[model samples]
Target chain A: MTGRLRALAIVLGLAALLIATVLADAARRRAARDAEASHRLLVRVIRLPDLALSSSSRWLRHPSQAEPGAALADLPAGLDVDPAGALIGPPRAVLEAGRSR
Target chain B: MRRQLALLDYAVGALGRRAGKSAALGAGLAFVVALFGAALLLTDAIRAEHERLVEEMPDLTVQRLVAGRPALIAESFADELRGLPAVRAVEPRVWGYYFFAALEANVTIVGTERADPALDAALAHGRLPREGAEVAIGEDLADHLGLRVGDAMGIPLDGDIVFSPVVGTFGGGSAIRSADLVVARPAHARRLLDVEEGWATDLAVDLTTEDEARVITRRITERLPGARVLERRLLRRTYELTFDARGGLLAFLLVPALAAFLLLAWERLSGLGDAERREIGILKAIGWATADVLAARVYESLVLSLTGAAVGIALAYAYVFWLGAPGLWGALLGWSNLRPALDLAPALDPLQALSLLGAVVVPFVAVGVVPAWRAATLDPDRAMRGAE
Candidate 1:
């Protein structure tokens, strides 16, 4: 009798755990669906570097014209100091160059 | 039923009495479960995010390779790709990494030949840059830099400083890789990245039919020797491979801990103490059947396994969803700074979770069986005498 009771307890406990797992998994699946939907919307709506404007205004505000005045002359090759005080350098190599400086 | 309830109650008391031993076993099991479960959850989240982003990715990416390194491709190459069959459109994309020295972050600078396609690209702000003088920033970047629409943002280029109007910030939907993105018009991107005129970072090819991806890849290769082609369909596999490798490395690091736990478990089960042996004998001497004794042992194992698993899983959930997975994130997904907006919703696959639980429980319960049976079948008198 005691043996049967202990066995039953073990089975019941396992069943409980499995039930919990299933419920949690269901909730997780719903969350995943919701997240993916939102993510799709986000990616489409907030695209970067609208090419129409990305290049046309590289220097609307020169760094040299800042209140404190940026030092544009110190920049090296593969980089351009736009009028807007933003440094546009070649991909990672220019970044490396800047880091070394 | 009453006797079974009593047995469970007794087993609980027994574990309580051996608190040190039980705690060690339970804690080890919990830690293992947490580690495995958390890794699986985080990987799933990362994969989901990647899948969402990949929908917008062009069918193929064609880039120029010079001396086995990526160099800018000419505008002519885009025209070449457009000439191919089933090739719908070829877009020359200008993108590069821009390091923000102040924040120690690398921003993705993308140059586009087309205009912001949407009526309101920055829906939150309901505007795109008005002219070449303006640029759009990702919401996270704007937050980090304390930028708002109309803020004049400046960047340092080689030998120059360029300031652009921050026309808008994009965010508040599903977190994409927009946090560190700086989108500008094509000309601005070219000048900023210093790609010479007539060259682009790469060409994004849209195919009329995806079934011809391999064929297009071959054709592009033949026409443009030394051009690297990336197919969008295969990106998921690449991401999966990367994530698997990182997960494997994490699992490998847990080997020592698991080994220690195994050793401890073996000593506790295979090397039973005299007191435990005598107690089993006392039960048998008192006319308790071998099956009853076995049941008690099984109950103990089940209780331990279930308690440990439950605690571990609960902790894993909290660790991943609530705490945001501190150590694991840095190790698994920490490569580039152009990171997707991290929104790891608590997601679990039933099959995967169940399999992990089974992996933890089955062996644990089975291992205890042999020692339990051995203890129970002993001659009651002999066990009582403490001779065996």
Candidate 2:
């Protein structure tokens, strides 16, 4: 009976912690939402379309705002693998196979 | 229901009997969970912030392409774009990267007309950039150079050095946008960035209607053969792809470690020790059914896995949101030496959390129980003898 009670307590404790984490995250979301207006104003004042990642190249730092054609060309020389291509490879393969058939 | 509780009780006590081994397994599992959980949390928060903030981004940005490289477009380009039917306003922007040789880092310098009223809210100290060569800088930049208001620093521009005064520092909600940034007037920016007076970096064009983006983009491309137009939707897609690719890469790197841990777990659980085998034999001899014995093993696995996952997730949340994810931040964000204080908005996706827990727990419970099942179904006498 003691062991069973202890087991019940452990399970309840874990569940409570999970609930607390969720509630905390909710509170943080609310806080971020409240500050949205100020961030918007900053964006207008700064006049930049992307985050300040502070990389060597503008294309690397501001991928979203970079010239679309130049962005692909300006990737760091050693990093030959295309991240987007790598991610979509399997799905693209399946689609190509279907099309070929 | 009552029988299940009795089985759970036995499982808990049994785990306690082998406290060292159980604790080691729990600790290892928790670390793996925490690593993956932190990466997910940070990625989600950054993506959410990007999406939220991008609502204010300009409709279209026009840049001149010189041999496939982005070059300065004429200030007159804004005037030409303003004449378009769908164009509402066009602002010529001046901004460029400045390489600081001493620190071996690049600083982004932007040219603004004057201090916008919106800036007063983000200013940590002093006044905005006004008068000759006065500049407002980001907090991280200020900290790196150890510059305060009323201080002057000489910036090396071309063969000559241009000395500028630190008029103000930006902080608070603006840190993410302004870190490693320097804002100066167009004249000062042109002199420092070496951009010609009549030329601007690019044109930020705002459209009358969001639906007109496609039409304007087509017109702009037609008008300027060498022009590269960046639409807001394309920018949003770029951000999504960047974050997803980075997150996916990190998760991929962790796959081998996860697989090794799973293998280790299988080895430890499946190769049941002599004492464990004998204990299972005694339970079966005492009229405990194979189902009862199997139930106890499943309960033990559940208890360990759930507890480890909960603790790991809690640690990850605190690591990311509270402590700012110390060691992991620099590696993930690709920052070296000086880094902005990453104040990410906290985010927790319940579905993501459940999937992570399920990924760990299901394999663990299966690996742990299958061997216990074999032991439970064995003849009681044979099992005891085999163990001896």
Question: Which one wins on lDDT?
Answer: 2
lDDT of 2 by residue, B227-276 (tens): 87878866677667767777667777877767777888899999899889
Best by DockQ: 2
Q: Write down the TM-score of every candidate.
A: 0.77, 0.88
lDDT for each residue of candidate 2 in A1-101, tens digit (9 for 90 to 100): 68556766876597567758756776876587665565565567766656665443445555555554544554321132244432232333432332211
**Which residue window of length 10 is worst by lDDT in model 2 chain B?**
B330-339
iRMSD for every model: 12.7, 11.7
lDDT of 1 at B29: 85
Estimate, for each residue in A1-101, the C-alpha lDDT of model 1 and write its tens digit: 45544564675577477558745764875566565443454444332211111221222111111111222223110123332222233465544554522
Candidate 1 residue lDDT tens string, B1-388: 8788777777776776687988788888888888877777777665554554565667887877776556788988888788889999988878776767655566667665444445353335636554585677777777777888888787877656789888767665433445666767777777777778888887888899999999999999999998777777775565556446555655666667656766667677877778888888999988888988888788888888877877787778777766767776544333333343345555566787887778777777767767768888888777777665
Clashes (N, CA, C under 3 Å) per candidate: 38, 0
Docking class of 1: incorrect
True contacts kept of each: 0.05, 0.29
